[model samples]
Target: MNLSDLRQDDLGLGIGLRTVHFGHILENWPDIDWFEILSENFMHTGGRPMYILDQVAERYPIVMHGVSMNIGSKDPLDLEYMQELKVLRNRCKARFVSDHICWTGVDGTNLHDLLPIPYTEEALKVMAEKVKQVQDILEAPLTLENPSTYLEFAHSEMSEPEFLRQLANETGCGFLMDVNNVFVCASNHGFDAKEYLRQVPWDQVLQFHLAGHSTFETHKLDTHDGPVCDEVWELYRLAHELSGGRSTLMEWDADIPDFDAVHGEALKAREYRQSMSSTSSSLEND
Candidate 1:
């Protein structure tokens, strides 16, 4: 397959590559089309993670998803980290690099959390510039995610989708459109998720994230702890229909189940996508 033609996947489903499923994957090499790996997991000099990464890359296509890009922070770019990532991408033949839009740390301190940024013009500009620097260093555009936020900024200039579009315009980067993040944000901020999805530039979407979330009395949290809810599944179906079925990934990070359970959830997504495609084709035939 011409790699560029692979906007999503033939199977329309992907399992988040975890260590627990590595052996099963290596042994059988299941029918999974692709896998997304945490960029930090394989950043080390040498270890089991790196070895497995090499094996997987050789077997199936892999994309790099990271936590510590820290694109929105005021601090300078992490050149050292980027260099290591570039090497990893080269070694593993990663399809693309992606990270959350929030900042991870400041003042040379790693907070180990994807912290939200204020929705101000200055903040947007800072993030766009950082994305540009990262792309230039890596000699390719990066993918930024719409994070699940708990708070909103008092001095915000634009909506979250507007911020994402502007960031893409400035940096010429693609997007990793996380449907669960938008759902969590909407439940927390009381905005319409469909409007957010409509306003986004769907053509530039490189990946689609589907994961589970938890709801509290005050708001919902994008915790990929369990199966994706019906609401999230509905939104994901809409997104895939809109984006022409981009790369779809099922993320169940915490309380991860055995290999069979994860694979089953992914297969369910593929079924949903196929059902939608059939409906669309029927309409056209009429």
Candidate 2:
């Protein structure tokens, strides 16, 4: 699939639409570039949540991100879930739909976590076929995010970025590059975070996810609990330079703060973008 065939838009800076911020969003209609909604939240529901979503959709661009889709699982694809996803996408007119590169469940049971997949040629072939099937179902290009992993498969044949690059090359699916995930995985797995960014297929990256994580004695976690750390922001700056910028979103899912605080954290991306631009201009003048 041609890179240009993937439909993507630079939606500027955005934050995940959490329930805590609904009142502020509707009342003030804040100056956010866009809002990303968890696909499952509004999938089989109505009432206040759906109502607010409708209002938000009318005002701002919406993008659907899902924790399910379990694209790597051995279970057959869930046609019903994908249909609901398609319906919701049309209902809100979301720019595109995204999910993680990890599996969420197996054997009809949901683990309720983003489980890691082995980076191997066989997994790549299976994932590419599944991605193509999903895109066919949605009738739009599907974007997958890199998974933050604590452990690596001993039998794995390639790095995660290489696997993702091959997947996109084969399937025409875009990527939602989560910078925090890169940092977390790098810290836990002992890989160079910047090198991971360099290996990413930036041409297929449709959006970037920035979030905060927790540090533990053994490993770092993708908690999204607070503000982004300095290192992640530095990586994000490099990502913006590499991808020439894309629709960036701040994800704050746990210990959620007030809307203003979350939005404030998100706006930091603009500062980095400006810095990257200035550096590029200076280089050009040399």
Candidate 3:
């Protein structure tokens, strides 16, 4: 994958479009670069949320990130859901559509969570086929985010980054690299976060996600509730150096804060991005 394959613009420094800040967004229209809409939120509704989304989309560039694609599931693909997703994409004029690289549910039940998939070849083939089918329906590259897992499958054949690389190559799909998820999973699963960054297929990465997570005695939960931690910031630094940066977004889904607070947190990613840019320039000059 090359830069030419990613036709979308890199809309820098965004926050998830959450309802807690809807009034602030519409009234103030803060100086953020873009907003990532949870695609499902606007999918089945024609209510006030949709109205506000219309206003926001008109003002700033929009991207669609969904949780319910169920790309790795054994269940049949939901054609009606895909059609509705595309409708929402067109309605908002989203620059691109993204979902997690995990399955949501199986056997006709909506689990409503991003469930992990094993990293075996069979699982990879299933996900790749599903991803291709989805892209064909949406008529665009379907970007997938790496999920933070609490456990690894025993029969796995590869590392997470390698699996993601294969999936991207096989399906011609894009990636939403979540730096914090890498940190969380690395710490929980005992892997080098920097090594994970090194192995990522940066060329396929279309956007980046930075968020905060909660730490338990035994493991970490990907609860995007507060400011990004320092370790994740350093990992973000590594990722920036590798990918040369991409459209980065901050996610704060739990214990939500005010619009300004969340936007300010999102802006923190800029420090690493800018500093990396300067360092790269200095090296080039040397």
The best candidate in terms of TM-score = 3
Higher-lDDT candidate of 2 and 3: 2
- Give the TM-score of each candidate: 0.94, 0.96, 0.97
- Candidate 2: Cα lDDT at 178: 96
The segments of candidate 1 whose C-alpha lies over 4 angstroms from its true place after superposition are 1-11
lDDT of 1 by residue, 48-92 (tens): 888888888888888889999888899998999999999988888
In candidate 2, stretches whose alpha carbon ends up further than 4 angstroms from where it belongs are: 1-8, 280-286
| Clashing residue pairs, backbone N/CA/C < 3 A, model 1 | none
The alpha-carbon lDDT assigned to residue 45 of candidate 1 equals 54
What shift in Å separates residue 179 of candidate 1 from its native position after superposition?
A: 0.7
lDDT by residue (1-286, candidate 3, tens digit) is 2334563467889999999899888889899999999999998899999999999999999989999999999887899999999999998898879999899899989999998899999999999999989988888889899888888989999999999989988988999999999999999999999999999998889899999999999999999998999999999988888988789999999999898899999888888989988998999999
Candidate 3 stretches with Cα past 4 Å from truth are 1-8
TM-score of 3: 0.97
Per-candidate clash tally: 0, 0, 0
* Candidate lDDT values, in order: 0.84, 0.91, 0.90
Q: What is the C-alpha RMSD of each candidate to the true structure, in Å?
A: 2.1, 1.7, 1.5
